[model samples]
Target: MPPAPLLLLVFNRPSLTDRLFEAIQEHTERPIYIAADGPRADRPADIEACQGVRDLVLNRVAGRDVRLRFQPSNMGLANHIPSAISWAMEHEDRLIILEDDCVPLPGFIPFADELLERYQGHPSVAQISGSNYQNGISRTPCSYYFSGIPAIWGWATWKRAWKLYDRTMPGWDALRNTPWLSSLFHDPTHAHYWRTLFDDAAHPAKGSLESWAIPWTFNLWTHHQLAVTPDSNLITNTAQSAGTNSSGTSHRNMSPATGIEFPLRHPETVSRNEEADAYAMESFYLGSHPVERFFWRLRLPLRLAPLRRILRLARRHLTHPQPGA
Candidate 1:
């Protein structure tokens, strides 16, 4: 069977959008759908930005199967992306998603193909993500590990799964006041961060997807599902530092993980690696915290170890084993 069509959400960044479109061109026989966010009239540059994207798509390779959805009005993030995804699902049973800033390794398409095929019927399977947090946990890889973070960047989902997506959250607001919901997702630190984000969105001046993905995470946990992936990250999040909302600081040297290994059979047993999972959550939370910034500065030398540099370099180079510090 043909792989699911790629659902692409594009906005202002023509440079990044150009690169991602080129990546899609590199793939074979995959249908592509472009959801171009409508232009904003009041903000002149934002209007120019959206116009630039339309120009970019028009010049690209066109197929009878290729499709586009152009909105006449700016819907912002909450509407543009979720609606774009919905449009894709309406046309196809499954979809692999991409934003303007997500660049894919060449292997990403094949890796997604393998997992989508493997887990099509697995009820416990929630979603497949191309990005994995590069936490050095168990060296023994068991396909992909379970994470509470339902990252939308470089992700794929079936219509059945996305049907559960709740952007206009009702239960979540009530749960935000409860510790039970807080503790279940773990890391009170990150929970508070999400709470703050949602609180900002409560009045709604703009879109907040971090708050939106919480429901998906909650549903996954309640069902005890797992997201499949290789030991390495297939997609690089290029948006963190470059775009509109940098969220304070940006990540540099963000390289896509190499070696997209495909597993033959899905692991029947689900084991929750508490330490690995907790460390993953804790690391992200503390890294963004002010005190930890000072702590990481104190340990900068240890963090910038020669070994760390070598592994980072080697992660992109399949030929070389990471050099010893």
Candidate 2:
């Protein structure tokens, strides 16, 4: 049998799932896998989003081959996504991951396939992401430096790196003890949101969003893994609920590269677009509420005193976010 090249992890966002399927259908030759999260208990939104995901899995159109891994009940976002991805990836050497909120352009498939082969076992190559926050990154072309932030929109990864995937919060206290590692904390200029995020994840009465990404970043940082990206943005993220804790909000500038051209390319070196990385850290961590992400590039060795305090405050706030829409 041919190897499994792609895996689509869908929750209850049928609308977004439909858009994703439409994008995938545009180039439907690769093998596809769909993992649907079982319904959850405390969900507030209309489960209507999930229905579209179900439909896509059931109604496979012109794909080369497809498989479905459906959950019996809701497992919530954190469990559903990481579990589904780890499961699918366990079966393949490397696989691409797509969340429903992300919509891919035509070049997404070729972009992923080319990178999958290019970085098959390169230790430095952690994952191949498909979006570029840098507006002018395309001019340089080929591949660019690693972004601390990993994009779920139209992305691929190798299982060798997946082995480091720690679903359970491993070495939390130990993570804090590594002072030099503190430099990896998303720059203060970029926003110390991940610190706050992990804090919330640690709370007993909290939801799971903060837990997943924080640990994932920790994995990449500790191992010194590099994540490269294509010049043209491949996936679109439609999940920005805008406000902190997301209270049914909306805004513009939501889609960055809506229809940007994506092209396949040969191997090349790409440097860190620090300016763009700064922007992504701000938006992803601090929320798009105009709060800029912080950066402490000068704090080379990472003094444990201040880093500890910052991490503590972030945890406190994430667990009990300030009043906002």
Candidate 3:
């Protein structure tokens, strides 16, 4: 069977968009849809960059089965992406989604395609993610594992799943104030962090925040759904600073694009990996609180023998006081 159509979300980043588009061209021949959000009017160069990105797609992808959706005005990531995705889903039952910054490995296309078909109408399966943040630890024996945390670096979902996406977070008021909110996350810190995010997005009293993925994630969790992730990462998030909202960088969570050899090794049972999910909560979703960061710093020496040696030398120098003497 043919793979689901792919939808790409781009903004004023022609270089990154070109790299991603090339990756898609290298891997699969699935029908492609491109959505380019308009440039911010304040930035004089934005319009030129945005147009360059659109032209790059048009010129390079000429004669291919491609569709373009260019926004007339800047809708920002919050509005542009979800609306573009909804528009793409109207033409197909499922879609493989990518952002300008996300570059897929060779296996990513097939990996998402297979799982998209496998979990087609399964209400419990929320999304199929190509990115894995396990830091080389294989948490499950299966080729793919399940978790409630959805990774959007590279992913696929069905119309059924997308239909549940709530941008306004309609039931936020009741859910936000409930005791049950804390129970949803394994760690209280994560619960608090997510609550803050949901509260900000829902009310936006400061008019500074706007997003769709947080609400979409909340929708999936409320419905008790899981996302499937590969044992090895098949996608790379390359743009952490350039034209992106992602803050900070980590050695553990970021993986280089690597291929997954298939006819896929399917899991014997469909069950969520609680350990993996908790790790995601503690490690990725929630920034290390003061206590967690302290613990991590304490554990660093043990994890790295070189660091232990350096610390010991420093301690000995301080205790001996040889230089001052």
Winner by lDDT: 3
lDDT of 3 by residue, 1-325 (tens): 6878999988888889888878888644678998989988777788888899889988877888889999877888888888999999889889999999888887888889889988897778989999887767788666789887888888999999999998888888888778766776656655665675676667665433456787888888888889999988888887554666332212234755556777888887778887887777666653323343333334332222233244445545555768656
lDDT of 1 by residue, 149-187 (tens): 565668887887877766555455676577854665465
lDDT, each prediction: 0.63, 0.59, 0.76
Pairs with steric clashes in candidate 3: none
Give stretches of model 2 more than 4 Å off: 1-4, 42-52, 61-64, 135-143, 185-191, 202-211, 241-255, 258-275, 291-325
The CA lDDT at 43 in model 1 is: 65
TM-score of 1: 0.76
Q: What is the lDDT ranking, best to worst? A: 3, 1, 2
lDDT of 3: 0.76
| Model 2 / residue 19 / CA error / Å | 1.6
Clashes of each: 0, 22, 0
lDDT of 2 by residue, 191-295 (tens): 334444444454424223433555666677667776776655666777653211221111223336544343444445534555556665544434333312232
Candidate numbers sorted by TM-score from highest down: 3, 1, 2
